[model samples]
Target: MRRAAQGMLATIALALLTAPSSLARVYLTQDQALALAFPAPASVQRRTLYLDAAQAARAGREAGGAVETRVVPYYVGTAEGRPVGYAYFDTHLVRTLPETIMVLLAADGRIRRIDILSFDEPEDYKPTERWLQQFPGRGPGDELSLNGGIHALTGATLSARAVTQAARRVVALHRLFVAPFPPPSGPAPGKGDGAPPGAPGAVRP
Candidate 1:
């Protein structure tokens, strides 16, 4: 019996060593998270807008005729060795509702970036794949030059709007709460006390 118990203990130790670290536990695998982030589009429409910086000034001025409408912009940079503009999405399983938020931060309280990560109901929320694709490679100075004219995907305008607005919210939050808060080394604090690394929010895996 003692031998059998020792074998069981050894097996448990082996499993723990092979598992992903605690930090990795909180984050879902990329594929699994993406599944929740982007949903099926209800419809699609063709529209074109010039994403160039020069064109933005022209659109902002003339701001007439057929122009781009779905213009979303974001910044990309780094802080304390971490990429600052990649969106962060967090949600709890309790409410069955999640929030996707994008945040940009500098070493201090300044927003130098943006991206809309979300906690949304897939059925009610439009997928963001198309809208997000628009901001790639855009520089910090580029304006969300929507005077160009926004393309609408037939029945998908609601989805399009959701995507655009989410981007706007992210930008706003960046400006509001832009600080370099790195992932916590310990768990989130409880009612009055702080949580340590292995508890609740502290438990990653």
Candidate 2:
């Protein structure tokens, strides 16, 4: 009887291993993400933002994380020495595993695009690319929580929440770090550029 039980468990494990989304990679690399976000990027700089305990707590609250992850990576791009935009990824729990979402933010902090890196959830529960269209042009000021601002997925509540939270997380993190750093004071040398871009956000299309 014990042998039979062990065989059953092994069969279960084998079945799970053969499952479609089980441990299968479905997302682009970080380098690939950056490349897609910027085809002809003049420069792509990797930046890290570390938050103090208090700020960490706040970030968690904003991201709906039970305990905040303190270190975050943000990528900034430039074209011909002019600011292009910012790119970042946020990982949040959905179902059992975590999903990484790559977000491309315009220079003004509005969401330019959202790329689902890997969603380890059930096939039926996967959010469609069309569904992601709802988030473009949204930014830190908007509440991305489902039903409040963004619409909710009928069946995939957790995935919807997880992604929405992740979006909010990165935008909030951007606001906390990048927004504070004042850009070149007054008018830039040759360009009419003056001051860093503001986060008034984008108009929904």
Candidate 3:
């Protein structure tokens, strides 16, 4: 009888341990961001950031130096009429700024591909993971007010704000630069642009 009780308790504990946390949320990818908000054709290339130090330095100047940035690739795919998925750079924004920033190229205003150039944050970052999910359907057009969309946690407001700001910055950059240019034939992305080093078959497009 005691053994049976122990077994039941163990089973319950296991279930609790594996259960999905209620606070967990999900975010979109680089390709998705473009689909939701297409940049002008002229601004597409300006969205990308190469991994070389010189380029990083240039980006620093552009972003007001001292802020690291990672370049993420967004491919926008479309369906019949309305927008579908919205993609953004998949790298952690607040934690990995300056190290990686995302660039988006959209087709039919939907995201179809994603490339994450830098992910300085630990892969298992728990606090910020839930917050990233809040950005998928939002854009500058959303006219997001502070304290809108997702609520910030009591202890993690700073991280949440960083994410929101980062998303806003990305959207603003695309709108400012890429929204005006005509669509050019997107070239096959090469190494060091956003591809993870030594990862075979890891192209964004």
Candidate 4:
């Protein structure tokens, strides 16, 4: 009986080690989470993003630290077989706990929404849904920081920062790897906006 109990204990321990740590006790599964972002999508494309040494360095630069995972599971949400948006959950180390945050990007690669999949930190450390709302519609070049643009949490600075950094990394990755992005086309040549270079009928000396 003792031997059998020991074997069961060993099996449990092994499962814990091999399972995903970010999704620790989370209520939402991958499909459900994706559905929240995209309702009735035609299909979800699954891909894996691999970062080489140089790529890792660049991603780290954007993240302001080493990314928690090198290999990321990427999902493309499509409708009618046309790509609508991109999404992927990344594990960010919030102090001691690695929290899973699912970032959704628009077709233009801007952050559409952020969902906190799982976090084991204290309740006080959890950023409220309103606080989380501040992330949507923010682009890669936007200055995303705790005190800079985003409101700072009272005592959850680390958690806030971790989430912010993760957002930046996702945007950076989109620009770096995700492709066929067109340059920001300006107004037609010889056509200017905003007062048309001067008032239409302004008196000139």
Candidate closest to the true structure, highest TM-score: 2
Residue-wise C-alpha lDDT for candidate 4, range 23-129, written one tens digit per residue: 46575677888988788835777766655566667657765667555566678888976778888787767887678889999888888998888886666787778
Position 124, candidate 1: lDDT: 36
- The residue ranges of model 4 lying beyond 4 angstroms of the native Cα positions read 1-25, 182-205
Can you list the residue pairs that collide in candidate 4? none
Taking the tens digit of each residue's C-alpha lDDT, what string does model 2 give over 127-199?
7788889899998667687898889888888888887877887776666556534234332121232322231
* Pairs in steric clash, model 2: none
Give the runs in model 2 whose Cα sits over 4 Å from its true position.
1-22, 62-67, 180-205
Looking at model 2, report the run of 10 residues with the lowest lDDT sum: 196-205
lDDT-wise, the better of 3 and 4 is 4
In order, the Cα lDDT scores of the candidates are 0.36, 0.72, 0.42, 0.71
How many Å off is the CA of 59 in candidate 3?
A: 14
lDDT of prediction 4: 0.71
Per-model TM values vs. the true structure: 0.31, 0.76, 0.36, 0.73
**What's the TM for model 4?**
0.73
